[model samples]
Target: MLQIDCPWCGPRDETEFSYGGEAHIVRPSDPDATSDEAWADYLFMRTNPRGRHAEQWCHAHGCRRWFNVVRDTVSYRIEAVYRIGGQGPGGSHDPA
Candidate 1:
């Protein structure tokens, strides 16, 4: 099983958390002005990056707070954890 390090609750089972998809994903404000393709792209598209990746996760069974995590997709190893309002060792936010 994969072990995820929670910033607030320490390392725990992967089942204790829920993946929140790619981090730094900002929803468009002007949905009416955006095309259908744009909306579909935003809703369905995601980058499944290898190596170290910054992602958003919710501590479902722990503190129940949403935070960011840097993990290796290939090895399922976590490098660091950080709160939403703080900076992680891999830097603050993911690419926009």
Candidate 2:
């Protein structure tokens, strides 16, 4: 089983958490002015990279808090974990 590190509760089994899809997705600034296609894209579009990818996860069975994770898609290796609104690995800030 994959092991995920919860920023608050320390390392745990992947079963303890829930995947929250791709992270750092920016919502439309003005829904009223957003085109239908743009809105749909915002709602549905996501990056499916082959290597390292940033994702969101929630420690549902533990703290139930959300955080971001940098993981490798092909190898299922976790590169980094950071709290929401905090800096990720290499000092990269969460823009969401």
Candidate 3:
């Protein structure tokens, strides 16, 4: 029963959203020059941190828009919520 704060739609039930996986993933600047391992890493590698994690979530049932959320993996407590292009409370990556 997580109450997610949608940037455009306010707080809403967790059921209204879809988990969009880990945030702050950077795409290759030159895909043509990128190696296969690098491309594979981009497609597969993810940092599964145990403490606070930054992630993307989409408000599917409400606004149909995607946003970012900072949450504690152990306690499931939301630290902050921001739009897709915005930065989390303590995050450095822009996610845009």
Best by lDDT: 2
lDDT by residue for model 1 (1-96), tens: 878788778889999999997776768789999899999989998888878777899999999989888888998888878877677774566433
For model 1, what is the alpha-carbon lDDT of residue 79? 82
Tell how far residue 24 is off in model 1, in angstroms.
1.1
TM of each candidate vs. truth: 0.79, 0.92, 0.92
lDDT of each: 0.83, 0.93, 0.88
Error of 2 at 58 (Å): 0.6
- Candidate 3 regions exceeding 4 Å error are none
Global local distance difference test of model 3: 0.88
Residues 3-64 of candidate 3 have per-residue lDDT tens digits of 99999999889999999999888999899999999999999999898989999999999879
With candidate 2 superimposed using the best TM-score fit, by how many Å does residue 29's alpha carbon deviate from the native? 0.9
Error of 2 at 93 (Å): 3.0
Q: What is the lDDT of candidate 1?
A: 0.83
Q: At residue 31, give the lDDT of candidate 3.
A: 99
